[model samples]
Target: MTAQHPSDVDLFAPPRRSGPRPTTTGREIPHDQLDQFSPPRIRAALIGHATALPGVFTGPSQVSEPASLALRLHDPRGRWEAFLYPSPDEFGHIHRTGFMHLTVPRPIIAPLIEAGWIEPHPITLRPQWPDTIVMLYAPRDEDELALATAIMDASWQQATES
Candidate 1:
């Protein structure tokens, strides 16, 4: 986690999301971001806002599969708390869905999960990795987009806790 994440991520902005959670698969290397993914236009809007944040940069993903562009920050509030794989390539990556992966604080992880916004990353299941890595569901509509961006902001702040 060399720092860098983005968007207006307010991890605790609203009450728990309602309804059933999106169908998410892939627990191993290529964690799937399936079901209710954002369209290109929505994804673009998310990318635009995320990249616009200070200290965040867009580049090839160090962790994800091919053709995945990720957002990372310049530093961190703590250890390995930066970097977000927001979307994946349609042709080259397993996760065609546009959901993102990043590490957030432990305190917020439970709330996020309880709220139905995220799932624990498989990496977190291992002893070496802390329970911070999570897969945020992709936004399918305007409301979801706003919440997603807010979560992004929170991730960004955690990474760049100056």
Candidate 2:
């Protein structure tokens, strides 16, 4: 057997096409504001799922222009650390899409595509935080609200009892 160098692995592969581009309702809530609504435990719970969703990161002061939130997601290939822009201005993409792309190394994009967690979107770099790629998910509907409320209640109950 021959020894393989860690650098020998090929990283990037073309993204798999998605069916029917995702639609957005243009609804949005800032991550800090979410603290008033019991935080985002709903999204936090999915961290263990096969295709993990990212979590919102908040800073000390209220988010102003050019704000960014660091996020963590899991794909088949590995864990990805990304950034999401929850600002109300240019970074307000989260308000529109309900999700944001946190760019992974070129190599990890294929895994995210295969896992159905992300697809290609506009790529822009923030000078302050060079590693972040943002994507916003679609706005939540009534069905999602009910489901989230139920999940949060169940989680709260479990936590209190434990």
Top lDDT model:
1
Tell how far residue 20 is off in model 1, in angstroms.
1.8
lDDT tens string, model 2, 8-32?
3222332222343344322222222
Runs of candidate 1 with Cα error greater than 4 angstroms are 1-10, 75-77, 81-96
Top candidate by TM-score: 1
Instruction: Supply every candidate's count of residue pairs whose N, Cα or C atoms clash at under 3 angstroms.
Output: 9, 14
TM-score per candidate, chains pooled: 0.78, 0.30
Which lDDT values do the candidates have, in the order given? Answer: 0.64, 0.30
